[model samples]
Target: MSPILLTEDLTMTYHVGKVDVHALRGVNLSVAPGEFVSIMGPSGCGKSTLLHILGGLLKPTSGRVIVDGEDLAAVGDAQRTDIRRRKIGFVFQRFNLFPTLTADGNLRLAEHIHGNHRSKAELAELRREVLGLLGLEKKLHHKPLELSGGEQQRVAIARAVINRPAIILADEPTGNLDSENSEIVLDMLVRLNSQFRQTIVMITHNPEAAAIAERIVEMRDGRIIRESQPDRGAKRG
Candidate 1:
C-alpha cells in the first residue's frame, strides 16, 4: 500500500521583503497508514512549515506532497481544499474552538463542514462515539470557557477526528497545557494512534511528547537530521 502521507523533495521559500527565507530544504518523508511520527526541531527549523504544507494549508515552492494518493501541488485551490477537508485533520498548539459554541456544537460544526452524507441519526451516533472516545461525553453542553485547557484540547482533538480523515497533522498540540494536562492529552493521542489506527504526523519540540510516537524525526537548518524509533516502554511526558 502507498504511504498515507509522502513528501518528495519538499522545498519552501518565502520572499519576505528583500530576503528569501528558506523554510524547507528538500524534505523527503513518508508515513505509512496507522503510523505515528513526530517531527522535532528548534524554532525556525521549518517543522511547522512542513506540517502546514502537508496539511495543504500552504503550497511549497518546489516539491510534491502526496496525501493519501493525491498530489497537493497539482490541484487548484478549491480541489485542494476539498482534498484537505476529506483526507486531512489538523490539531494546532492553540485550541481553535469557537468560544460561543458548546463542545457538542463545535463537533457538529466539523461534521457539517466535512459534508458527509450520513443521516442525522448516523451523525448523532458518530458524535456520541467520538465524544465518548475523548472522554467528553458529559461536557457536551459546556462552552470553551467552561472547560479546562486539557478538556478544550480534547474537544479539539475530537473535532479533528470526527470525520475519520486519513491523516492527522498535529503541531505542538501540548504547547499551551500544563504538565499534568499535557500528559493527559498526549496519552489520549497515543490511544488514538494505537487503538483507532489513526495515521499521525506531529510537530513538537518536547522530547517527551516525541517519545510517545512510534518514530521520532529530528530536523535542523530546514532538513531532516535523523530518524529513530522511540522506546515505547519508556516514560513519556
Candidate 2:
C-alpha cells in the first residue's frame, strides 16, 4: 500500500528581523498506513515544525506534503483546514480540556465541531466505545477538574479519536503525566494502534516513550539524522 503520509524535501523558514531562521531543512519522511512512528529530537530541532506541516497547520516554504493523497502544499487555506479536520487528529502536551465540560461533553463538542452527521444513537455509541477503549467510561460525567491528570489526558485522546481520523499526530502525549500515568497512557496508545490499526506519528524526547513505536526517528539541526526500530525489550521508564 502507498504511504498514508509522505514529505519530500520539506523546508520551513521564518524571517526573524534581519535573518532567516530555518526550522526544517530538506526533511524527507514517510509513514505507512496504520504504522506507529516516533520522532525524537532536542529542543529547536524542528520536530514540531515537521508535525505541523504534516497536519496541514503550516505550509512548507518549498516542499511536498502528501497526506492520504492530498497535496497539502498545493492547497488553499480553506482546503487545508478541511483536509486537517477530516483526516488528522492531534493530541498535544497540554490536555486542553475545557474546565467546565464533562468528559462526555468535551467529546460531543469535538464531534459537533468536526461536523459529524451521524445520528444521535450512533454518535452516542461511538462516544461510549471510544471512552471505554481509553478506560474513561466511568468518568463520563466528570469535569476536567474532577479527573486526574491521566484521566484528563485520556479524555483528550478520546476526543482526538472519536471521529476515527486517518492519522493521529501526538506531540509529547505523556509529557505531563507521572511515570505511572505515562505508562498507562502509552499502553492505551499501543492498544489503539494494535486494535484499530491507527496510523500514529508521535513527537517525544523520552526514549522510553519512543520505544513504544515500531520505528524511532532521531533529528537534529532541523534534519532527520537516523531511523531505526526501537528495542522494545529495554527496561521501562
Candidate 3:
C-alpha cells in the first residue's frame, strides 16, 4: 500500500533581516496508513515546522509533500485548504475549541465545515462513538471554559476525528495537562488508534509520550537524526 503521508527532501527556510534561518533540511518521511508515528526533538529542531508543512498550513521552500495522493507543495492556497479540510485533522498543545460552543457544538461545527456525505443519523452515531471513545460522552454539553484541561483536550480530539479524516497531526497534545490528565489523554489516543485504525503523526518533547507510538523519529538541527520503536511489549502487526 502507498503511504498516506509522504515528504521527499522537504526543506523550509526563513529570512530574518539578512540571515537565512533553515527550519528544515532535506526531510524525507513516509507514514503508512493506520500507523502511529511520533516525532521528538528539542526546541528549534524543526519538528513543528515539518508538522505545519505536512498539514498544508505552510508551504515548503523546496521538495514535495504528498498527503493522501495530493501534492501539497504544488497546490494553490485554495486547493491546499481543501485538501487539509478533507484529509487532515490537527491537535495542538492549545485546545483550539470555540469558547461559546459546547463540546458537541464544536464537533458539529467541524462536521458542517467538512461537509461529508454521511447521513445525519450516521454522523450523529459517529460523533457519539468518537466522544465515547475519548471519554467525553458525558461532557458533551459542557463548554471549553466549564471543563477541566483534560476534558477540553478530549473534546478537541473528538472534534478532530469526528469526520474520520485520513490522518491526525498532533503537536504536544499533552503539553498543557498534569501527569494524571496527560496519561488519561494519551490512553484515549491509544484507544482511538487501536479501535479505529487512525493514522497519527505526533510531535512531542516527552520521551514517555513518544514511546506510545509504533515508531519514534528523533530530529535535531533541521534534520531527522534517528528512528526507533519503543519496547512497549508486543508490536501491533
Candidate 4:
C-alpha cells in the first residue's frame, strides 16, 4: 500500500519586507497508512507551519505533497479543500468546538462538510459510534462550556474522527490541559489510533507527548534535524 501522505523537499518561504521567513526546508517525509508520528521543535521552528501545509491549509512554496495519491499543488483551491474534507481530520489545542452547539451537532456538521454523503441514518450511526468510542455518549447533549476541559477535548477528537478520515492531524492537542487530563486525552488518542488504524501526525512541544508516537521527528530552523523512536526512557534534550 502507498503511504497516505508523502512530501519531498517540502519548502515554505515567506518574503516579509526585505527578509524571508523560511518556514520549511527540504522536509522529506512519508507517513504510512496506519502510523502515529510526532513533530517536535522550539517555537519559530515551523512545526505548526508544517502541519498547515500537510492539512492543505497552506501551500508549499516549492515541494510536492502527495496525499492519498492526490498532489495538492497540482490542484486548485477547491480541489484541495475537497481532498482535505474527504481525507483529513484535525484536532487543535483549543478544541475549537462550537460553543453554542452540542457534541452531537458538531459531529453531524463535520459529516455534512465531508465527502460521500451518507444517509441521515448512517450519519447518525457514525455520530453515535464516535461518541461511544470516545466515552462521550453520556455528554452528547452538552455544550462546550458545560463540559469539563477533558470532556470538551474528547468531543473535539470525536468530531475529528466522526468521518473516519484517512488521516488525523493533531496540533498541540494537550497544550491547554492539566497533566491528568493530558494523560487521559493521550490514552484515548492511542486507543483510537490502534482501533481505527488512523494515520496520525501530531505537532507538540512536549517531549512526553511526542514519546507516545511511534516515531518522533525533531525540527530546527525550518529543517528536520533528527528522527528517532521513543522508548520509556525518552526525554527532550
Candidate 5:
C-alpha cells in the first residue's frame, strides 16, 4: 500500500531580521496508512514545523509534501485547504474548543466546517459513534469548561476523527495534562489507532507518549536523526 503521507527533502526557512532561520532541513519522512508514528525532539528542533507542513498549514520553502498521493507543493492555496479539510485531522495541545459550545456542539461544528454531506441522521450517528469511541458520549451536552482536562482533550480527539479523515496529525496532544490525564489521553489515542486503524503522526516531547506509537522518530537541528520501534521492555510514564 502507498503511504498516506510523505515528505521529500522538506525545508522551511523564516526570514527574521538579518538572519535566516532554517526550521527544517532536508527532512524526508513517510507514514503509511493505518500506521502510528511519533516524532520526538527538544524545543526548536522542528518537529512541530514538520507536522504543520505535513498538515498543509505551512508551505515549505523547498521540497514536496504528498498527502494521500496528492502533491501539496503543486497545489494552490485553495486546493491545499480543501485537501487538508478532506484528508487531515489535527489535535493540538490546546483543546481549541469554544467555551460556549457543548461537546456535541463542538463536534457538529467540525462536521459542518468539513462539509460532511451525509444526511442529518447519518451525521448524528457518526457523531455518536465517535463520541462513544472516545468515551465522551455521556458528556455530550457539557461545555468545555464543565469538563476536566482529559475529557476536553478526548472531545477534541473525537471532533478530529468524526469525519474519518485520511490521517490524524497531533501536536503535543498531552502537553497540557497532568500525568494521569496524559496517560488517559495516550491510551485513548492508542485505542483509536489499534481499533480503527487510524493513520496517526504525533509530535511529542514526552518519551512515554512517544512510546505508545509503533515507531519513534528522533529529530535534531531540523532533521530526522533516527527512527526505531519502541522497546516493549521499557517503562512507560
Candidate 6:
C-alpha cells in the first residue's frame, strides 16, 4: 500500500523574543496505510510540530509534506484547510471539546464544518457505528463535564474519525489520563488499528505508551535519531 503520510526534511523555526528557537530541523517520517507508528522524544523535541505540519495545521518553514498523495505546500491555505478537515483526523492531548455541546453535538459540529454534512439518518448511522467501535454509544448525550477524562478523550477520537480520514494524527493522546485511563484509551486506539485498519501517526513521550505501536521512531534535537521495530528490543523513553 502507498504511504498515507510522508515528510522529507521538514523544519520549523520560532522567534522566541531575541532567541531563535528551532522547533524542528530536518525531520523525516513516513507512515503507511493501516499501520500504527509512534514518535517519542524528550520534551523539547519537535514530534508535535511534525504532526501539526503533517496534519496541515501548521505550514513548514521548508520541506515536503505529502498526505494521501497531495503535496500540501502546493495548495493554497484555504485548500490546505479543506484537506485537513476532510482527509486527516487529529486527536490532541487536551480534549478540545465545547463544554456546552453534548458529545453528539460536537460530532455533528465536525460534520457541518467539513462541508459534507450527513443527513440525519446518515449521521445517526455513522454515530452508531463509531460509538459502537469506540465503546461510547451510551455516552452520546453527556456533556464533557459529566464524563470522565478518558471518556471525553474517546469522544474526541470519535469526532476525529467520524469523517473516515485517511490518516489520524494523535499528539500525546494519553498524556492527561492515569495509567488505568491511559490503558483504556490506548487499547481503543490499538483496536481501531487492528480491527478497522486505521492509519495512525501518534506522538508520545512515555516509553510504555510508545511501546504499543508496531514501530517507534526516536527524535532528539529536532531530528530522527533512530527507529526501532520494538516488537523485540527494550523500549525507550
Compare candidates 3 and 5 on TM-score and give the better one. 3
Assess every candidate by TM-score.
0.96, 0.95, 0.96, 0.94, 0.96, 0.93
Question: What tens digits encode model 6's per-residue C-alpha lDDT throughout 167-218?
Answer: 8889999999999989888888887777677898889888888888889999
Number of clashes in model 4?
Answer: 0
Indicate whether candidate 1 or candidate 4 has the larger TM-score.
1
- RMSD to native for every prediction? 1.6, 1.9, 1.5, 2.8, 1.9, 2.8
Runs of candidate 4 with Cα error greater than 4 angstroms are 232-237
lDDT of 2 at 84: 94
lDDT of 5 by residue, 1-237 (tens): 989899999999989999999999999998889999999999999988899989999889999999999999889999999999998899999999989999989988999899977898888787777777788878999999999999999999998899988788999999999999998888888877877888999999999789888899999999999999997464333
State model 4's lDDT: 0.88
Per-residue lDDT of model 4, residues 106-193, tens digit only: 8767877785668878877877777777888899889999999999999999988999898999999999999999988887788778
What is the C-alpha local distance difference test score of each model? 0.91, 0.91, 0.91, 0.88, 0.90, 0.87
Q: Lowest summed lDDT over 10 consecutive residues: which window, candidate 2?
A: 228-237
Error of 6 at 225 (Å): 0.5
Candidate 5 residue-wise lDDT at 131: 76
lDDT of 1 by residue, 142-215 (tens): 99999999999999999999987878889999999999999988888887787778899998889988999989
CA displacement after TM-score superposition, residue 174 of candidate 4 (Å): 0.1
Residues 4-50 of candidate 3 have per-residue lDDT tens digits of: 99999999998899999999999999999999999999999999999
lDDT of 2 by residue, 1-237 (tens): 999999999999988999999999999999999999999999999999999999999989999999999999999999999999899989999999988999989988899889977888988887777878898989999999999999999999999999988899999999999999999988988888877788999999899899999999999998999999988885332
Q: By summed lDDT, which 10 consecutive residues of candidate 6 come out lowest?
A: 228-237
